[model samples]
Target: MPVREFSSSVPLWAKRIASAIYVERRRAGLTQAALASRAGVRQATVSQAENDPRSMRLDTLEKILASLDLTLASARRPH
Candidate 1:
């Protein structure tokens, strides 16, 4: 609910990355707030990463990804 899965403005690649993060967070049974707490970031940062990662700092994204048991490299790979 924190992120829109797709949109006219969002690129396919970014969507894929965002989807990966969104799916993993759901799979891990975590809300954006919970993930933020675990990742030591703000809920807004998690939301931004899930919806539009371009604005997110790499370290913040890394923290969120790590909290989901993922790595930046894995998120970049095509599904």
Candidate 2:
């Protein structure tokens, strides 16, 4: 799948996180229900995270990312 470019209106961090979750979930061939079950969250939560990651808590994001065998990494931005 092609990476989506969020407009300037959306926060860059939220867009990156949401896109990563969406791409990884699709790549893993797991439905929202399956992922949510593994993550110990509701299917709606998974859906919401993929659609609007900024609204999700850090722990919840971590759970979902872990379930998908993905990890969060940070890099310093060039100034």
- lDDT for predicted candidate 2 compared with the true structure: 0.75
Error of 1 at 51 (Å): 0.7
Cα TM-score per model:
0.83, 0.78
- How many collisions per candidate? 0, 0
1-79: candidate 1 lDDT, tens digit per residue: 4555567788776776787789899888999999999999999989988887876778888899999988887887664
| Per-residue lDDT of model 2, residues 1-79, tens digit only | 8767565776766676667777878888989899999999999998877766776788888898888776665211210
Q: Which parts of model 2 are misplaced by more than 4 Å?
A: 2-8, 74-79
lDDT value for candidate 1? Answer: 0.83
| Candidate achieving the largest lDDT | 1
